[model samples]
Target: MNQPLLEMQDVKISFTTSTGVVEAVRGVDLSIYPGQSVAIVGESGSGKSTTAMAILGLLPGTGRVTGGRILFEGQDITHFNDKQFEALRGNKIGLVPQDPMSNLNPVWRIGTQIDESLRANHVVKGSEHHHRVVELLEEAGLPDAERRAKQYPHEFSGGMRQRALIAMGLAARPKLLIADEPTSALDVTVQKTILDHLDTLTAELGNAVLFITHDLGLAAERAEHLIVMHRGRIVESGPSREVLRDPQHPYTRRLVTAAPSLASSRIRAAREAGLESAELVAATADGEKPQETVISVKNLCKEFDIRGQRGEKKVLKAVDDVSFDLHRGTTLALVGESGSGKSTVANMVLNLLEPTSGTIAYEGQDTSNLSRKQLFDLRRKMQVVFQNPYGSLDPMYSIFKCIEEPLALHRVGSRKEREQRVAELLDMVSMPRSAMRRYPNELSGGQRQRIAIARALALKPDVLVLDEAVSALDVLVQNQIIQLLAQLQRDLELSYLFITHDLAVVRQTADDIVVMKKGQVVEQGTSDEVFENPQQDYTKNLINSVPGLHIEIGTGENLGLAE
Candidate 1:
């Protein structure tokens, strides 16, 4: 075998925390050979990302390599100074960070950022920078590179911004690329496209890839070797399929069991195991659905007139003729890519945004013609929990205050009764009543989301609108949240209008699925009908875009792989 492009032998990384010294990566041994793709998968704080960051000497805060060595081409650079690391960064080891919004400078044009990287690394001459910038963006799957190069990051969408970051990362054609959670925030279709581009680019250039992600399906599908880390230690390492299909560690098994893929509905024989889609359709045929209708949207249409390039009025129809029905004590998922009108539909249902033309009825009452007093009273029965719990919540507000604010706004009860209700709400979400006094900043992402759910349920509403609720959470936390939602729906008899871009999550939480695209409904049916017999090409494409669906993992249901 040829020598490794990069190697880490018994690498021990640590950081100095407020409490004491903590080891983040403990004696992890890894290797990335030339022209090979390797992946390290684990949950947050499992040392996968820490090991990758250490390779480029980019550990944040007080983190340091406490023991062992990291060798590049047989050269020891474990203790390389900032100057040495800079020379190695863009020139040889390029990095594609997790969040493109924060990574790219908001003030500078996208082209300027890529050009700056090339200038710092001396990859292109000053005279050739413009042409090279366009070339890089074009290679990164962007269209009309010239016009895109002149635009700022804000002008681009989430997928476009990520592609720009990839273009910048590979501007110098580095021999070894470190992609850290590159597509975590992207839509499924967008994520698949970006990963495909990376594969082709790496293969053509004969470059090596070190992929760091929390997605086991991605690791198994994208890389040759898989390494699973847990609690700062390597728990499992082998061929991707071998490790994924038959995990030895308990944590690995839990992770495999928790992955919410579409295949779970039917591994071999069933949508809900013994509950077949055909049978489900038959049982509920001829208007046999017994559940009561809670919310009804008919011919929903929303349009925005925006100033175009030259200040001319341009009509952008965000939601066009969309319709769906939400039943009591059930879940209805609106699934699609980003900007596919899912959120717009949800906003319309929440009465946060009025439709240009259509009707939204709540419990057989038309919500569009509701007066001020009626609207104010109706708010107590419908509530929403937005995406990004960090931003949805106010930093200055304590958990108790955050939950109490809604009750206070509605004037539901006295001060003492509100306090008692807040306590009960926390208990429902499984959060400690003691944490009621704590602030949002002191909690983790999962904790914040739990608090957000509790706050959403504060008014004892019958309907819950969760817009990308669990998209920002880790895999384990996401599973927990899904389970919590299930329990809440069953216990409180709440109906959920869940809007998200991930169909994998839809398979887990949604009872009825509505697939949208380009402001139109592409497909709508029960979970079994959609997953078992998808009727549209777009819907089929979305199912195929799931990362590890094609793998041969015994039964498709248990391992959650699709044929």
Candidate 2:
């Protein structure tokens, strides 16, 4: 192998807080050869990003490189001044940040932003800059390059925005690209395109990529080398295939085993276990009935008022003649990318937003024309768990109070009863009793989400709507949440309206699946039928776009683990 394009030796980064020094990266070693992709895999707060920041000389105000040697092209750059580092940025090294919305200036046009990046890197201005920006967009595989250049970042979709970021990074033709979760928020289709483009461009340019993400499958697909980070330390490092095929570290093995596709098998096994358990009891004869429909939507239509430069028009058809049914005591997943009307359908079902047309029947009761009072009553029958854990819960309230609010509001129980119920709910959701006193900020994302689920269940609702519930969590945490949801459904006979962009999650939790595109249901069927023999071209494309789909052994077995 050729000499590495970049190397970090015995690197250490720490933040000085009032409590003490917080070491974010400790004794880390990494190298990226030209044209090779290296993935730094870890959960949030695992020091992955901190290490990347140190490499880019973009660490937070409080963070300092306490000890390290950062070498680029065999040259030591530990003490490079701002001007020197600035010269390297975009020209020598480019960064694709985790949050595209946060990284791209909201006010700037996409083309202008790319132009500015090029200018900063001394890539020429005026016509030359414009031409380079267009070329970069083309290279990034963004369609309608000319029109997209004039559009603001807000106008672009999540995937398009991410592509624009990649275009910006490629504008100066940098030697190295540091991408932090580049495809994290994108749908499988867009993710595949972006990653494929990255792979192609990197190969053509002989440029190296320092990719960072928690998705082990993605790492396996796009990277050649792998580094596993945990609590500010590099726990493992090796060739990507070798690392994934035989992960020496326990954390890596756990992540591999926790993947959604793998979890689907576990779900299947659990279902079989339940069937066996039912057979064991003489009175519980093999009389288990097939699940029935819980919520059914027919010809659902929802149009959004698009306040555009032209004028206010109902041009955005958020949900267009969508039809689906949620089975009793089973999950019916609505899968799509952002703005595909999955969330809009969920909102309409919850009565948070009114649909322009169509009928929503809850256990055969038409819900389209429900009055405010009727809607309030309907709320008791159906509960919602939102995507963001922090945004869903009231930070001011304790965990116990948060969970109890729904029961108290519905007048289900007295204060004393509510408190006892909340404790029971927490226990049911696998939360610690001690957590009742903690605020939302005190809990982990997974823990906070468990509380949200408990609150959702407080009404004893027959149906639950979970919108991107586990998409925000890391693999292991997501697996746990998925398993918990399945177990809860079995125990309480709860039905789920699971809306997600994650195909893996859909496969795990959804018995039936609905694929939506441009506000319409393009396909609908059982998970097995859809996954095994997708009829619609869109559905087939979605299945094909799933990263590492061909590699079914999972990170655990691939990484070399034996249960």
Candidate 3:
């Protein structure tokens, strides 16, 4: 390859804490050639983001490079001062951060934000700047670019906000673009569109990309080269296809096996790998009699009246006559893009939101007519796990307390018994006993999610309303959680109302699937039926939107593993 556009030789980073110094990034070596796309793949706290920060001189708190060098265009930049770094930041190296909502200022208009970046890089000025902003928005795939520019971040959807970020990142035509989990929270179709746009634009502009993410499948699909990181160290690195086909490290193998896209391809793989029970697999077989319904929804409708800018009332039909059934010991996934009413249906079923019209029956009892005491009793039979564990969990509470609180509130057992139950719940979720004393901030994303699951199970509910529960997790953690849910469903005879935009995950964990669009049910059927013979154009589009869908995986032989 030509001379590397960027190189890190034995780079080390550390942060000062009250206890002592924490070595976040150990000695590491990496290189990126001009116009090349490289991905650093790892789980949370694996130092992937830290290495990127080190390159951009944006490390948080007291973090600093303690050893080695970072060379850009054959020039040492490890010791560059902040003033010097600022000169090159937006002009030569641009960044698209993880969370668009948090990164973009809420008070600023979309056009103003992009204008700031363009101005900072001295790319455009005067009347020409406004036109430049519209051009950038258009290039980023936003429709009605001029109108969108005047809107605030809150007016745009998650995917649109991300596109704006991408436009800003590419505003200056930087030589290098660092995208940190840019599409981690987006729907599969939106993710594909954004990634495709980024790839095409970067390639055309001859800009190298340093992509950091926890998703091995996405990394393999998007980048030419892959570098696997584990505990602040490089575990493996090679051509993306070669590493995926024959992972040299055990960690890499785990990542490949855990990918949702690959895992969804064959349900038999779950049973054959012993991740689930044979009986559970048999229950879902094509010829088996239908299971009893646990929760039923009919003619569900939810509408909201909003005041427009001119003070005119507007009726928004968030959910329109949606209906579905959740069978005992089975998972029924509600899949759709953002604002498609998947979460609205989930909320109505959970009784957290009152429907404008319709009936929701739990065990043949109408939840709408349930008395206050009856509703309180119903809480014991149904529990929910949210998308963001960090937001759901109480930072002030320990893991033990978080789980025990539900048991205590329900008066399920004695104080001693509740303590014992908390321990058992931790074990059930595969969490360490030592973790019981730690706060939510002390745990990683996956660990916190496990704790959330443990807490949810403390009530021993018959049904779980999981709203995008595993969408934020890495492939390995997501796989583990999926297997745990399957086993629990079999052992406890629990039903799940799974809501998500990820059809890949829905295919693996859901027995039945419901596809929603613009507050309406576009398609609904068994997982096999929908995946194999999608009836709706929207359903086919969703299936086609899955990343790495066409990338073939080796049949165990390439990885030197037994089938």
Candidate 4:
């Protein structure tokens, strides 16, 4: 491979804990050649992001490189000091962190951060720096880069901020680009767009990329090579197409099988095999069933006030007369584009925001006029996992404290009992008890999210509201979480109010589907019925817009579904 551009030889990372030393990444070896795009895939806590962080010299303060050699351009950069690493960082190896929401300085202008990232390693101050910043932004495919350069990170949308992060990463034309779950939070269209840009950039720059993600589909689509991590070691590594088509390792095969698209296919195949029909008939035999109605809404309305340029006010119906029912032990997915009131309905259900009009009932109880105490108790029965895990968690608290807070607030158990419960909850979420002491910054995006889910399940809530819980996760971790949710729902008979824009997730996770448009339910049915025979124009449009819809596994080329 012409002396790989970057190499990690027998890399090992550990963190000192009260109990003992915890090994995160163990005896792992990987390499990246010029113009090559390699993906690192694993479940949460598998050290995928840890490996990427090590590459960028951005590992947490508590972590130590127990043993390894990080060779960048054939030079062992493992022992590089802060000053040396800082110099090499942007100029040689740029990083696009997973969560741009917090990685970006909310107070600083986007242009300023991009310039700062570039100037950190190489000085180019004043107007020259500004020009270069704008140029980099343009190269990253951001529209009106010149004007956007003056705006703060908050002024930009999630996708725009992610593009800005990429622009910053490319500011120095680094030899290698490391993107950790770069498109994890984006919708399918935006995710495809981002990957397309990355592909274009790699081809144009001839720079190697270390793309860290869990989505096997995305990794297969974007990367030339794939590396699968399990626990702390590499289980599989090979050409993306080969590995994806015929994964050798059990872990890799499990990941591929767990992917939402692949899972959906399995579901379809099982239905064709009459498995679903038999299961549905058996489930139907459970008499009366209260129709399994977990959540019922009628004429739900939400409005937002937007001000005019002249300070005049305008009340807009963000969600208008939205209505749907969530059945017991099944996922009811709400799908729509950005600003489609999917989240608005979720917020209303959680009682985080008051609705403008209409009714929301849980288990035949009207929640519209509940008192503060009643609402608080209702919240205990229904918990939420937000879209951004980092934002949802308290930065100052450890994972243990974060999970414990909910239990304590609900007065579910005593101090010692709560501690034990917290441990069990962590274990239930497939996280180690040792994660308790680590802060949010100490964990990866997927780890933090698992903790968030654990916290939500602390009180054994009957209903769980997952608002893009798996959206920010890599494909592998996303699969694990999806499986976990399915298992948990089956075991506990828990109802999931899954709010998402991803049609793929809807297809896999949802039993019933609710298609929302302008805050109204345009179409509703079983997932199979909705996707296979979408009745409404809006629902059909959403299904048509799904990316990678026509990707062929055996053909090795575009399946040619649509552009």
The reply for model 3, stretches above 4 Å from the true place, is 266-290, 559-563
Q: Which runs of model 1 end up more than 4 angstroms from their true locations?
A: 262-289, 554-563
Worst 10 residues of 2 by lDDT: 277-286
The deviation in Å at residue 434 for candidate 1 is 1.7
Best of the candidates, lDDT: 3
Ranking by TM-score: 1, 3, 2, 4
List the pairs of residues colliding in candidate 4: 214-474, 214-475, 214-476, 215-475
Quote each prediction's TM-score: 0.94, 0.90, 0.94, 0.77
Give a tens-digit lDDT track for model 2, residues 196-283: 9889889898889999888877887789888989999999888776775676788877776676644443334444456333211211
Lowest lDDT 10-mer window, candidate 4?
554-563
lDDT tens readout by residue for model 1, 66-123: 9999999899989999999999997899999988878989999999998998899999
Clashing pairs in 2: 244-558, 244-559, 245-558, 245-559, 245-560, 246-559, 246-560, 247-559
Off by over 4 Å in 4: 1-3, 8-27, 57-84, 120-135, 138-147, 268-294, 308-316, 362-366, 369-462, 472-481, 491-493, 517-523, 534-563
The TM-score obtained by model 1 is 0.94
How close to the true structure is residue 524 of candidate 3, measured as C-alpha lDDT? 95
Worst 10 residues of 1 by lDDT: 279-288
* lDDT-superior candidate, 3 or 4: 3
Residue 435 displacement in candidate 1 (angstroms) = 1.1
